[model samples]
Target chain A: MSETKKLMYVNRKAPYGTIYAWESLEVVLIGAAFEQDVSVAFVDDGVYQLCKDQDTTGLGIKNFSATYKALGDYDVNKLYIEKESLEARGLTLDDLMPLVYEDEDDDWAEKDSIKVVSSQEMAELFEQSDVLFNF
Target chain B: MKLSIQVNEGPYNHEASVSALNYTKAALEAGHEIFRVFFYHDGVNNGTRYTTPPQDDINIANSWSELADKHGLDLVVCVAAAQRRGIVDEGEQERNGKDGNNIAPGFRISGLGQLIEAGIQSERLVVFGD
Candidate 1:
């Protein structure tokens, strides 16, 4: 039963404003150990968590945004960023960190982990998941 | 289908609990089996029996207590979170050497393992938070 279920972590808040973003990442890191089919969705202000060059030194935070780059190593690489959210916030994919993983199926080629999906696709993704984690 | 709900925010402070309650009620009305309600973080505050809201407002804790009593749903507050928040049952009070217990009726103090167990046992795990 370990890898049989579809687990989705739905992030709807911005990073740094509250502890939810950091704590959610903590859960994602721990959940990776369970070896489940983990997928993360960046909706609303959640996309900010992956923004490039997050300077948290002034805020006195650890600046854990870089940890998203390592999610591929844990085999939790499916990151769906809502297109509407990004557009509304006037952000493009170029504004975020480049996260890619080696595609084991294709001669160990590289594959991008960040996927820009429509809101409808996001809803379908939610429909297909066994678990919906929002914080 | 069996559904497990995780509430991560405290009552009154956030609409997470209220949304969870509504979604849960809707799920039950739609003939879904609720496996458990796992309260974590400040969410455990929803289980404190001492929460006395004004007459003008709804008592969220009591709402959950009544729902549990009516449907026999398991309402579990995480022990680690509850201990930090001072939400204790009689057993917990005895174990922690505390003078009093404030665990609301129809709710029990448990561990984070209960949340994992729910995820494994139920068909769906729906989380609500701020």
Candidate 2:
């Protein structure tokens, strides 16, 4: 393992419509083993990746939304969703899955996964990333 | 500066690989070190050695192979993406009971981790996709 450099998985596509969102999550899970400082950002249409009440049963696809919830278990807790994207889509924080992680330093406190940020803030996060995986 | 490039589209059908190749050539000409070129999704289709474009069209696979050979570059096609898209190397073909391999010269099939490794080792990770 090398240094724990910051990695950002930029999700700018809608899930299910294409394989990009699903495959991007796969990379995030595999990359977890490397112990890199990984953060997932949902921008553009990518914000839909975390949309709540997703039902893929009718589409003959395995519902992978739960996997996003499980990302916290993999120690990938940082998820940033662009506030502008949500607003443009007429979606609020209520429209997304409730993702959270246990904050051990804060005495095992739970934290929200959706760290909503403005588009400019998202750009800052992008600048901080050593590797930006755009899928 | 050390750089890593990722291509997300296949040859002929899309311009992503072409742009990536051009960017890489310019980078190298400007004395930038390209740590690796990792092809993902449809981009893995660029590694097929069996591609034979018409007399007028450029063969994208050969272009990548030539560029890689010229610079001793690591050209890796994501194995998971490749297998899903029917692109295979010699070992992959044998393991999967396929009859042949279509991996181009100077290109190898690898996992997504190779892309991550390239990202870790390089200063920038540039992506070219549809």
Candidate 3:
């Protein structure tokens, strides 16, 4: 209602091993409807969520990985990946899905939304957020 | 300070629900204003009256019900999550054609927007779970 408040949705779990990741994504999708300043942070096992080639066919579970791509359309552009988390998981930005959003203010130019930041920078982001929803 | 609470885990299986209850009770006793308590994920299980633990153990949902009644707290169980887990109220029961509703007293089924609203309105938002 008031001017947008900075909201950080912190994900710390793997996408499939538990329900946290999927539910967190649901919250983000719903929260996006509110038109608030939103940021999604992937830390620890949460980093696995963005890994490309996610195959859930054998698992017989609904694969929600592709939903992350749709986030751009919701105006939820900021996706922060902790550098340490990716390294610990032996993943690089190259291993992640290339998520991009169109810049409406700049003639709809496409730009990358994923930003690999250090843990310190993640902490600074934590401080910068008006509210934090952890999953 | 005005605060909001989020519970992400189910009762008994994890200590999170009870811990949230304790923390909320403490906060209320300390004279802090609780803007809302939004239950999501498996946390919606905390709103069901179907939980029947050992007689010696605590009834987590009842504890929350009693607390909400006493403090006039807003205990909101997310509708989407609740429907998934089958924690329904009378309205949900009628709409979903459920045989009966299991929502406990003082707990209401609502949308995730309640959570976003809590984050926007509260001075502090506390989360309890992994």
Candidate 4:
């Protein structure tokens, strides 16, 4: 096994409109098996993926928003949502689903997985990553 | 330098696959080692042997096949993505009970693990897509 590296999946597209959002999530889930330090960043139109109450029945598509909640089980708890991106789209943290994870280090205590970061902070996060998977 | 590439769009329709191919060629020309090239999303279309572009237009898939043949490149199409898009190899066709296999020469259908492995093993990972 290779040494664990900071791997970030950068999501910048809207869900359903294109396959990128779902495919990015698929990679994140599949990549989890490798036990690498993983972080998912929702930026630009990507912020729409977490919007609560995503009803895809009308579109005849599988509603995958629920799948994001399962990331905690895979030990993928780091989710960084860009504040600027959300604000630009007239959305707030309340508009997004509350995603949480059980922390093994803290005796299985549930904690917030989504961290709303500023654009500057997001840039720093990008610099910190060893590999960036853009979607 | 050791590099890995990911192409997330289909050939011709988007410039992504072309850009990725050109980048891989340039990197190899400059004496760089490409650990792997993982095709995901519609990019798996690049591995279909059934592509029949006109004589005037470039057959991008064939170009990739030729490049892989010459360089011994690991051209991997994500199996899940390929299956979703109907780009199947003989093994996949047998396993999935498909009537035919359309995987181009020098291309193999593999799992997403290969993509993650490329990210981990390569010195740099480049993605060409929208």
TM-score on alpha carbons, each prediction? 0.75, 0.95, 0.98, 0.98
Give the range of the ten consecutive residues with the poorest summed lDDT in model 4 chain A: A14-23
What fraction of the reference interface contacts is present in each model, in order? 0.32, 0.59, 0.86, 0.82
Error of 4 at A72 (Å): 0.9
Candidates, ranked, TM-score: 4, 3, 2, 1
Which parts of model 3 are misplaced by more than 4 Å? Answer: none
Clashing pairs in 4: none
- Model 2 stretches with alpha carbons more than 4 Å out: none
lDDT accuracy of residue A55 in candidate 2: 96
lDDT of each: 0.88, 0.91, 0.95, 0.95
Query: Which one wins by lDDT: 1 or 3?
Result: 3
What is the alpha-carbon lDDT of model 1 when measured against the actual structure?
0.88
For each candidate, the DockQ is 0.33, 0.70, 0.90, 0.90
**Lowest lDDT 10-residue stretch of candidate 3 chain A:** A1-10
Give TM-score values for chain A, per-prediction: 0.96, 0.96, 0.98, 0.98
DockQ of predicted candidate 2: 0.70
The runs of at least 3 residues in candidate 4 whose Cα sits more than 4 Å from the true structure, single-residue gaps closed, are none
Cα RMSD to native, each candidate? 3.9, 1.5, 0.8, 0.8
